[model samples]
Target chain A: MVENTTHSEPSGDDIRPPKASIGVIGWLRANLFDGWLNSVLTLVTLFVLWKTIPPFFRWAFVDSLWFTDGAVCRDAPGACWSAVTTNLRFIIFGFFPYELQWRPLLAMLILFFLLFYSRDRTHWNKYLAYGWVIGLFLMGLFMKGGLFGLTPVDSTQWGGLPLTLLLSVFGLTAAYPLGVILALGRQSSMPAVKYLCIIYIELIRGVPLISLLFMGSIIFPLFLPEGITINSILRAQVAIILFTAAYIAEVVRGGLQGMSQGQYEAADSLGLNYVLTMRLVILPQALKIVIPPTVSILISAFKDTSLVVIIALFDLLKTSQTVLSNPEWMGFSREVYLFVAILYFLGCFSMSNYSRRLERELDRGY
Target chain B: MTIADAEKVPFYLNPKVRAVFFQIGVLCMVGLLAWYLVSNTLTNLERQNIASGFGFIQKEAAFEIGESLISYGSADTYGRALFVGVLNTLKVSLIGIIATVILGTIVGVARLSSNWLVSRLSKIYIEVMQDVPVLLQLFFWYAIFYESLPSPRQALNPVAGVFLCNRGVAVAIPEAHPAHAYILSTLVIAIVAVFFLRRWAKTRQEQTGKYFPVFRVGLGLILGLPTLAWVAFGSPTAMDVPVLQGFNFTGGMTLSPEFIALLLGLVLYTAAFVAEVVRAGIQSVSKGQQEAAMAIGLRPNLVLNLVILPQALRVIIPPLTSQMLNLTKNSSLAVAIGYPDFVSVANTTMNQTGQSIEGVALIMLVYLMFSLSTSAFMNWYNKRARLVER
Candidate 1:
């Protein structure tokens, strides 16, 4: 636009370009030092970066140990990731029979493939729908073992990333149907059932996740029959599933409430039964409306899985922290924590981007 | 009209029958699951013989809390110790919420600024923060910030006699005298007087189209009343500024780095969400309000203060309330950094006494109370904030 104006009036050679700035320097000025306040901020930020970067450089590369004889890390001035480099296998899969590690890794790859394939809208309604169900069974059999040449790995030994992924994936999938039922119950014809659903959802949503996990891991035992103990990781999985169901139920209910009375009336006029109405008519729209918020909840559930480290289940965070706890890896906490943090951030950010894309695309529908 | 009245009773398609069947199916499945877990726990407990009940509440905690609302020590009951822990959680979270809301609003507005640098800085801030897990952020601040401070003897920032150190910041507390107490009482009286005066001023303005200086009155009342209090309270105990006491600073109130780190992390994290809510609320208001206010002979600030905020607040409060609730829940992450909050104390009690159910129940109840009251207060505020739509 500025260029058009400048060319139309060739009164002067300079013509005072709207953005006279050029190249990297111009971009920096426009972004970082555009005004007095911005220039001040730029200086402050530059100072901070200058102070922080060199130490990281020295620690991560120059002075740090990348590989060692396991115990030779006492002399490093910066990061000591030698322990992580050495013990990454154990951290990724704790107490799992070492030979069985390949099976879990393979299962992870298949999960990535299925999820990647399903993300495409064309694939979503086609082959991926069937593949998702099939993939779950395959991921399970391969990871837990009972199929192929893999040795059976007990659920108790399921630690680290594999366990974290299973808990979150199943937590979201199981919660989807359970949450819809709860939402329907909350909107039920009977006051007793409606009120009960309301109270259950609100009460569970109000408290912290740690308390729920605590209830499942410890209190849940008391209400159960003798001699049928659930494993720790399984208990945590149940905890996340129940927790996510309560939250997603609320979001779905909000979506249902947002729908106009006309839609319901139309469905009623068509002589659809309640089940048929919800499944074929109301829920399809409501779920679409709630897709954005529910996706954020899914992301939160993924992040919250890290909290299981507290109960001593070795999820990604716990495994990293466990590695930190060892005297052998005492000096490498910063490097290990940062590495794990990057992995978490990347996973969450990509999902957030996808959800935003879904929101925009779905919102375009009538 | 409503699906034509069904004179003949429906068969299996009857809603009642379907509901009953579903309930029975769910109940049976739950009952089986319950049976399995109960049997397993009883076997596990019996083999272990862990006495389960709330009898542990009366026992001595035998663990000292670094901070307490009511004086507590190892000699105190486990109940008292748990109370102390809950108090700490409340103390940290309450202050954290206040700080976060203020900071979040500022940063949120900054992110929407016409100024290019401020907006970019805020965007970067929000991105860098949430990407890092909050627990790790808390550790980064705790380990990297205060842990890098100079020793007490080397006291970094000296204010009057106040000292900052790795040992913690020691601040000056006022030593009140009789005059200071009188001043304090006078200040409270001044505030009440200012309140009455402002109401009269507003009434007068409505009647006569003349405005009273409300801001000046407010400032005078708040500052003068406080000053009068200081004089009346007998000049108070001159702050017992913590002088460097060997390896640690001593004498004044000490804020543990754990508290600092936890509070900062929560504030920084919550601020990002708060900013988004604020931005949305502001954007939700029609631009015509600004134009209309300008047409009516109002300044930009007047438009914002008198016209815009009144509407924007209705949009803002619901999300803001949820953000506050989130901050309260996230405070439990204090355990990761060893800041002995409610769950931490309960955890210790549970581990030592093996009274898991009672301990967890107490913690849940406390959180429920906090959450309910917060939600209730927000609902009342929303009612007040709602548009009359007349």
Candidate 2:
């Protein structure tokens, strides 16, 4: 009976999908050429890519000048990537003493280590927080060295990538707690506190960061006592902190508003005070819910740190501009700016990707 | 357990008492800080001999604005220069918002296209645009305009009467005439009429179970009224084509490179965020809604308009309002790119007069006014879009 069945009936392997409905051709047909309109769109897009990509590839790679001097680059028919390669040190560490470049570089490595180590959800604990605190301390010591047998560098001399990182990371770290407090104050039942928090948030958020930086650079000194001057970097950092805190407060407020009444009532029924309720019950859940958005705020704040260039702070963008203004690097603004943009893009992209992953990981619990 | 017992509770321990005391304490601390800052500011201003008041706004600006909507020169007052800056800011922001909405909507829709290539391309565009800083993009565009584009003498004239050069885009436009104002007024009147007509049409459709071609009629009125007004006032058809004069073009509109770069960067960068918002809004409307509408014999276009869009827009408008506000705020980055926006003009004023306090205050006031007005409008719109519950 088995031999008869095998000879007369077709097996599962033989009864496969039709040739037109499976494999690469089917994929192409289904995805790109499903209908007349889609087919036309596919053709048009292909044509556009065909026209643009080859020329761009030639300009950016094939004929590009990588290590040449400005004179050769001027006559070259392609991009002068040497503008970035030659000024790499200045672009990364700004005016920090030439020999002491390793300090910022080392500090950056430590920052990256801390960041990478904390990326996994399993590693998230109080120890990770402690790691950040210690790592930040080391970074500070390295950047401003007086006790480690290293040359003391002025904060004004701190510029470029490290400065961008410092402003965004430290600013966000400091801002988060203040933002939480502000959010709590806004959500409080006390009218006076709520109004005060609301007004502060609204006022800070109404104006752009440029105006705040302007205030820091131009108007902040007037608010200080005579003979006491804050450095420009510190002023900018403070402005960033205040600006970012306002946005963070708004985001956290959304988280707070999203909590169900039942959660609060349950906490109350458990005889918990407001602080305990928020800390142990409400905030833990609310903060988790808002993690994705808070990361977005952080990403934007990181990008906004580049605005310090407007006030003449030698952040990465400003350093790139300085390089472009050089006689040797003249007319190579595109290469330098492109390089700086890629740096910023990488930082932002990785953070956004992490946020998305975290969102998915958190969603798994539901 | 009695009210008397509650009143007898320790004042420090009573929640209400603690709340009042906390508030009072906050107020006192805030008042003291404000007082200290003001005193310091006054002392510093006196020491620096920098006059701090709005009176400086009336002084001659003595600085040339690259471009201005109104008639402005270096001889203009600081107030007038600032007004020009305000106008420029409004011009860029309004134009940027419109362009961003259009481009963002298109990209957002493209991201969901049935064609995989189209969707992937749009996704890449969004990711790249969103990741890059807007200021950097502005700088990049500015550099391209200045360093890549040819000189005015060798401008790329893709079409007759249009010039693309390092200087800016010079385009031909219809010469201004008095009749244009009358036609513009009629256009506004037609728009108002269309609004009421739409309401009436909706009401009629609900009560009498009949549809009115409100859209077609509105379009006809909007276009026909403006045309009739133009004809009645003697159709002025004079064209003011840009012509090369000396090193630059004159006699027609010339959009400065700074404005172009700033507008392009702001629109491109903000459109990425708006695209995400739009995608989320569209996705929020469930597939069942579309299926149900189709089952009820509604046309595809009608299903999209009557069922999907109304639902989706409710999800769209709140975040979209924030995106608009963000675009407006980011336009302040024009200061970096040499666009004589409000912040740029204010910076110049601050530097010239050393009245930093007044300049900062004015900047804050103007921006706050913008934010408040926008939020107010959006709040009203959100109220209208909200679902009506029984």
Listed models, DockQ each: 0.41, 0.86
lDDT of 1 by residue, B21-64 (tens): 77777667767876876777767777778887788889888998
Winning model by DockQ:
2
Stretches of candidate 2 exceeding 4 Å from the true structure: A1-14, B1-8, B229-236
B1-390 in candidate 2: lDDT tens per residue?
999998888878989889899999988998999999999999999998887679998899999998889999999899999999999999999999999999999999999998999999999999999999999999999999999899999999999889999999999998999999999999999999999999999999999999999989999999999999999999999989998889999988899999999999999999998999999999999999999999999999999999999999999999998899999999999999899999999999988988888999999999999999998999899888889999
True contacts kept of 2: 0.89
lDDT of 2: 0.94
- Please tell me what DockQ candidate 2 reaches: 0.86
- Which tens-of-lDDT digit does each residue in A212-310 have in candidate 2? 999999889999999999999999999999999999999999999999999999999999998899999999999999999999999999999999999
Q: In angstroms, how far off is A54's CA in candidate 2?
A: 0.8
